[model samples]
Target: MSATRICALSELEQDTALRVEVEGVPMAVVLDGNGEVHAIGDTCTHGEVSLAEGFVDGDTLECWAHGSAFSLTTGHPLNLPAYEPVPVYVVTIEGDDVLVDPAVTRPTN
Candidate 1:
């Protein structure tokens, strides 16, 4: 599927995460302090909690339940309890809109 408009760019706050679901796929949309947008799976791999309800430190989103920090770029957990990685979606900004395709994911290394 092609990218779908999830939210407006103006709706996002720096270093904060917003939970969004597109076509039944849940995601966490984050605007980092550096002014870049990211889309990753919202479910924490360790605690199965919402990552959007967690904390954003730089490019990492830390799960509030277990403290597992996932890399915003790679989707890999950087701490204990969460060894699995989540899916990272491609983000496209058009005008004031933030678009994401739930069917599309970026290859992580």
Candidate 2:
């Protein structure tokens, strides 16, 4: 699938996540420590909470609900309270825009 532009790269701060809806899918767009963009499903695998509300440390996305952490690159669960992997998406930076492919699976942000 083709990537869709969600917002400008400058609009998102590093080590932060923004919740966005793409093609009716609830997703989170994260900016890592190196200013790279990554996308993933917003919902926490362990609950109905949004991942955007969680914290971002390096390549890890920590869910605020249960303190579960997931790798931004592989969608693998890194800590307790979460055993299932969250769905990850592909992210691309084109000039000033941040594009994301919600259908593609990715591990790095």
Using TM-score as the measure, the top candidate is: 1
How many angstroms is residue 27 displaced in model 1 relative to the true structure, after the best TM-score fit?
0.3
lDDT of 1 by residue, 28-54 (tens): 999999999999999998888999999
* Candidate maximizing lDDT: 1
| Superposed Cα deviation of residue 55, candidate 2 (Å) | 0.7
Minimal lDDT window, size 10, model 1:
100-109
Q: Candidate 1: misplaced stretches above 4 Å?
A: none
lDDT of each: 0.97, 0.86
Per-candidate TM equals 0.98, 0.91
Question: Residue-pair clashes per candidate, as listed?
Answer: 0, 3
